[model samples]
Target: MTTYIPQLTLPEQVFASAPASILLPVALGTTVGYSTRPKQTKETYNLIRQPPLRPPPWVFGPVWTVLYGLTGYGAYRGIGLNLTSILPGTMSVARRAATLYTVQLGLNLAWMPLFFGARRPAAAMLDVLALLGANAYLACLFFGTRDGLADPVAGWCWAPYLAWLSFAAYLNAGVGYLNGWDISDATLRRRKAVGKGAQ
Candidate 1:
């Protein structure tokens, strides 16, 4: 494929900048994590039937912080690159790759609410499944496969994220199966009320 060197636009300049790019996802992730009720998240995590090898609750914050940083860096790298030459009206490969990246980021932000805030394991599992699929495609796009743009550095940034998602999938499935896919606060309250009534 021919290399197409195009003028850098304002959007690209902003996203390609290190500080802005790196801070975007990190900030969003942190906000989502905190807004979703951190205390209840930890408490629910403790009460749930977790899979073997699940890390402690404290581990999540740091791990996600690092992952979001990498994600932003990857976006910076990918956005700054000259797009591979392609026909008009079909959308450039770079744009497609960028779009996929954004989609995966949204999926990433959505998981915490699904799993912790709403306490819907089944929905959370589905969201994770979608996140995994979308990210896999995104990784392919960034890595310069026939179906992807040519940016090895961006691809590498997403690799660790993929690995983490694999582990998360296992944990999500395990928790869903072990806990019968029901972990809502209402259910817990109902169970408590039933016990008191029986007494």
Candidate 2:
């Protein structure tokens, strides 16, 4: 089977670099986490019905930081370097891997906004489900290429992330179910206000 190789643009080249690749995701994840307001997110988490085995809100930051770093390092090792000279016939695989990496990164970034910012647990659950699938495929792509490129380190980096996503999916689903699928802060406030007025 033939796989199409994509040409990397200059910005892509910068992003795929050793430092930038790793820093970008970590930075972006941190930015999104903060932009959504950590205090508010923590409050929301406390307000909602969490699933059994849900970790404290504090755990998410450090865990995600580590995962993001691992993801970045994996990209740097698996997709950024020019394998043409070292491993002939691996560029196509690397390019495809890079494309997948970018795609999965976007999927990863969308979940926080969906869950916290928009206050949509159902949508966030769906987003994480897609993210899980995409990362699974990406991990496979990183682990072994059709043309005999094998980078176990990169693939292994995704292992923890995949496991976490599984747990996250459970948490997402559990929260949605426990809350009767409605956890909107605005709705909750409106109902309270209506109750006061009626009384």
Q: Could you estimate the TM-score for every candidate?
A: 0.83, 0.85
lDDT accuracy of residue 171 in candidate 1: 98
Give the clashing residue pairs of candidate 2, or none.
Answer: none
Cα lDDT tens digits for candidate 2, 58-148:
9999999999999888877777763443655777667666666776788889999998889898999889998898788878877775653
Kindly list the per-residue Cα lDDT of model 1 for residues 8-31, writing each as its tens digit: 222555455878878888999999
Candidate 1 wrongly placed segments (more than 4 Å) = 1-14, 83-91, 145-147, 189-199
CA lDDT of 148 in candidate 2? 33
Regions of model 2 farther than 4 Å from truth: 1-10, 82-89, 145-148, 187-199
Clashes of each: 0, 0
Which numbered prediction scores highest in TM-score against the true structure?
2
Looking at candidate 2, the ten consecutive residues that score lowest on lDDT are: 1-10
